[model samples]
Target: MASDSEVIARGDWYPAHSSRSAAAALVPRTGELIAIGADGVALSVSVVSALSFSSRVGAIPRRIIFADGSVFETADNDAIDHYLRSSGHKSVSCAYRLEKLHPRILVFALLVILLGVGIYRYALPALVELAVLVTPPIVPELISSGALSTLDKTALAPTRLSEHRQKIIVERFERVASGAEGESYKLNFRVGGLIGPNAFALPDGNIVITDELVALAGGDDEMLAAVLAHEVGHVEGKHSLRQIYRAAGVAGLVMLIAGDVGSGVEDVLTQGGGLLALSYSRAAESEADRRSVDLMRNAGMDPVALVRFFDALEEKLADHSRTSMLSTHPGTPDRKDAILKYRAGSD
Candidate 1:
């Protein structure tokens, strides 16, 4: 028999048992002599039986006595495990305790979702409005016109001056525009007599083609159609409008915060045309490509023509060591590859 005043230290394990009589007598039952550890300081604990065996032992409880002389009597294994784990005792089944805190994890997830919604719904629209306020309108037109003129002066001026060829090009543009779905905007094809082979679409739906680019295509109508379709994609997607809005919004916000709203506004209006010349975001580019592919397919033109056009242009520009075409029109190869991949998947 152990003395009631014995002090149990840490790192001890012990066995315990209990019994009751109809006469209500305090009869001590034969039980395992469980080791008492310092972890059970100020309280008494006993391992009734080993439910699991690992680095830590799991067991059922026969009873518990509090420091206040209150006795907790139970035979529930789960209850014993819960109490021990909650009190920071190492157990073979500690994982169950962790699962009990699932509500806390759910609350954290809800907070994240609410934060995302707030940014998208409230913050994004306000930012977009601020951008619109600061952007100058003239910038895009100047860049578009300047880019066209630069191409024309160098590549297509000679061809454009030929009235007959100019008329033919004009008629082709008209034909393509007629078939376009939306209210047709003004479609002008100026032949840039530049030696550098390239073509590009302006935000305002103006399409400029270089003499070198046309020559590279060997004057294939289908290739021209593919190029035109791509330009149409740019217009239909309103890529230019979005670019201008984004730039203006950013400039406006910066100006407003800097306490120089007057100068910023003036600068934005004055440089509006140039700001419009800003490149479309990657998302805009992808959207344009998708639209162009769809347009080409709908127009009874082989979408593969776009692939061929890119390949030919790449070869020609590489031969001349001219990177301007690639620079102005980024992601050509990737777009081509995507088209091919899409076609393969569809088939």
Candidate 2:
């Protein structure tokens, strides 16, 4: 028999064998669990029997069952667990050692966090690249179709440019786009609606150029072709799809790290998505600018035309108190400087 003073757990007990009798004994007598022989367990009531711990999901206190139709429970589950383990009895409790500040658990969690960061920074981008490489030619077409349809319903108006002028621009754009393959390049002309003087690429090969943008270029076919070539760079690089995926991945990773707090995480991720997209679009624009300069040089058009066009666009936006394409694509002066440098190098 273990000493009563050697209390491993302190809680209420029910000595009744039947549920009715147990209910009748509404008052619970204080009880303690103490170690006996190597594998034996005894309650404070002097009833020694095989003991086991069981718990229900979301239940706070743990229950200790005795073979002699008695029960014990305590809120101090850690004390109970420690007593059982120390007494050489098997303990089955859903308790994480991490809760007790176990070093190994903390290290494991740290490793998981580091691994997640590495995958997010490096592996994810590589995976996106691989995915884009294997994507079918028709996928972009379908994406463009759906996206253009949506824009048409909400943000775009039919092109007001004369058919003859539209045809001339289309021919020029085609010549600029000639070397690009696997994407069925289709030119779209739309009135800018809320987005003035913009040209953007869908995940598919459709490039939408605003009529405002065309008029902004002041009928400089070379400037228009440069913009078309830039959009082509986006399609070739799968920038739009990659941007969307990266934002979603980041949102998921943040939520995973945060655990289940509430729906606020979802709302934050959703609202921040557009901001992330804009940032990624800036990088995409830089890449497209590089490609545009190359295409302009190859097509025998002066690459300086693109730099001049960006300057004009920037001035126009400033005069109107409107956000330029620079709001998304960004880097007007730096991009212009880089283009001039590239032109100088190519000379």
Candidate 3:
């Protein structure tokens, strides 16, 4: 027979005997709970220590369970907290306590965010590189085959360049390819259309160059060789495949968490070819640039042609069109400086 003042929380009680429920109250200080039917005090229990409480989370209803397999649910989370703190029924979980805006909790939250950033920035690429090493040879061939078909269906058009022009470029490019060690590469030409002046590689040692890029090179064999050699470097290092794996790993993680995911991994590989050209990291781009310079020097071509091509490109592409390789590559001036310094050191 506790007074209203003694009731710390009010809720609906559902007895194990029936699905029906009635108004209930949690009376603190004396460790008692009461169910009030129309007749009042239909049941009373003195088992607060034996009761289990659901963890408190913002505004979500909390539950209390009794020894008789009955449940009491209430929205008055603060009253339950006060009862626990005052009576010391049992320690509430740290997660529930952290919901309060404490300085220490905010600091912990900040540290967690920083750790996530650190893992994405540093750990992800290292992990992706390791994955690339263990991946089977057939995997790259499969990804490359799918990606080429996807590109043909989406961004690329058949090459309109004549057999004579293609023959000459192919002959000249062979000299450049000869310097690339271990894996050999075959050069392919495309019309590019909206892709503008660009060159990129597939995972299977296939280097694709566009007619627009040939036109941009203005038939300077050294400049064309530089671009082709740069793409060869990407293939040699498996840079494109590494990036695709990195992105796919992230997509796979999101799918595992989101529960509604379906066929996204297949889509990323077979339908996402358009993204492959622009997904290169700046560090990867720089490494390819160095390899380009090294190969050009080895092939009896001037590495300075690459530096001059950058200068000429900056002059020609004053607008930096929204959908061009210039938009994704590292800053031209800094890259040019690095190339000059590198060439000087190599010489």
State TM-scores per candidate: 0.50, 0.61, 0.66
- Name the best candidate (by lDDT): 3
Give candidate 1's whole-model lDDT. Answer: 0.53
Q: Number of clashing pairs, model 3?
A: 0
lDDT of 2 by residue, 1-347 (tens): 33345546555555546432121111112333332332233332432235567642233776667666566656766766575576555644445432455788889989989989898989878876776778676755665566677668767899999999999999988888886756678898999877778888877787889999999888788989988888898878888767656665666676677765455433323332242234445667777887888777777787667887877777777676445466667667688888778778766
lDDT (CA) per prediction? 0.53, 0.68, 0.77
Tens-digit lDDT string for candidate 3 (242-279): 87877777676555445555776667676635345446
Identify the runs in model 3 with alpha carbons over 4 angstroms from their true place: 1-115, 255-264, 272-278
Write one digit per residue (lDDT tens) for candidate 1, span 181-211.
5535454544443335655666556766666
Q: For all candidates, what are the clash counts? A: 26, 1, 0
TM-score of 3: 0.66
Better of 1 and 2 by TM-score: 2
Error of 1 at 162 (Å): 3.2
Each model's RMSD to truth, in Å?
16.7, 11.8, 11.0
Q: Once superposed on the true structure, which residue ranges of model 2 sit more than 4 Å away at CA?
A: 1-113, 258-283, 319-324
